[model samples]
Target: MEIKIDDLTGKEIIELIGEHLQGMSLNSPPESIHALDLDNLKKTEITFWSVWEEGQLAGCGALKELNKKHGELKSMRTSSNHLRKGVARKLLHHIIEEAKQRGYLTISLETGSMEAFMPARKLYESFEFRYCKPFADYQEDPNSVFMEKELSHFYME
Candidate 1:
């Protein structure tokens, strides 16, 4: 798989992001959904990436700069066809490496609290991302679980 900085202009990427939003809508309440739409991902503060394999769009994720030393992971979604194929894991490690390369002291994310999100929670835990209170503009919500990983001493595999 080849991961590259996405310009968000292609039809495949647009559809992938649309599918991500649609999935979030189906799984989470309206007020609880935080998946970034195309407009949001297009913002300068966010660096979006797309994972492609053999010319097929495998997945996508983004890193949003919260501050000079902090980042918020966003838009982490693997195509349904790519599920359980290590796409998310590879993309996650890529994001972590990008954070460390960018000098981010910490990286954080917010995910669903439902059973459907258990796998995601486990993935973060495996990366040593600890549970934390909401950060940045997020407020506490029963529907959400916040996680943060300090990159100051994070070891990349």
Candidate 2:
């Protein structure tokens, strides 16, 4: 699999993002949904990537700069065809490495608290992320599950 910075203009990328949004809406109530759309993902503070295998889009993820010492995971979705194939894991690992490279001392994310989100929660846990109070402008919402992972040796880097 090849993972690289995405231009966000490719047809496959657009389709995949649409599918992701549709899935999120189906799994979580609209009022509790916080997934970013294409316009938001294109912001300068966010760096997005798409993974492709043999010329077909496999998955995508993004890192949003929250502040000098923090970053947020956004728009993480593995194509249905690639689910359970390590595509999400690869994208997640890539985002964490990039966060470290960018000098972020912590990485945080907000995912759904519903049954549909179990896999995502499990994935975050595997990377040592712990449940936390909402960070940034997020308010307390039962539908949201916040998690964070602190970067060790951040100052040394």
Candidate 3:
């Protein structure tokens, strides 16, 4: 799989993001959904990437700079065709490495609290993220679960 910075104007990236939003909306109420739409992903502080395999879009993810020492994971979604094939894992590992390289001491994320999000929680746990109080303007919402991973000594070479 090839992962690279995404130009959101591209059809593939737009479609993939659309699908992600649609899926999230189907699984949760619109009020509880916090996944960034394409416009939000275009912010200056956010860096987004799209993964491709054999010329087909496989998945996408983004890292949003919360501050000099912190980052937030955003827009992580693997295409239905790419599920269980490690696309999300690869994109996640790539973003984690990028965060370390950028000298971020912590990477935090907010994902759905519903059963539909259990797999995502498991994936974050596998990368050593632990549940935490909401960070960076987030509040305690029953529909949201917050997680953070400390990278104080994690160096990427």
Q: Once superposed on the true structure, which residue ranges of model 2 sit more than 4 Å away at CA?
A: 154-157
What's the distance in Å from true for residue 74, model 1? 0.2
* Error of model 2, residue 80, in angstroms: 0.6
Ranking by TM-score: 2, 3, 1
Model 2 lDDT-worst window of ten: 148-157
Candidate 3 achieves a global lDDT of 0.94
Query: Could you tell me every candidate's TM-score relative to the true structure?
Result: 0.96, 0.96, 0.96
Candidate 3, residues 44-112, lDDT tens digits: the string is 999999999999999999999999999999999999988999999999999999998899999999999
Tell me model 1's lDDT, rounded to 2 decimals.
Answer: 0.95
Clashing pairs in 3: none
Error of 3 at 80 (Å): 0.8
TM-score of 1: 0.96
Candidate 2, 14-75: lDDT as tens digits: 99999999998999888888999999999999999999989989999999999989999999
Cα lDDT tens digits, model 1, 1-157, are 9999999999999999999999899889999999999999999999999999889999999999999999999999999888998999999999999999999999999999999899999999999999999999999999999999998665669
Worst 10 residues of 1 by lDDT: 147-156
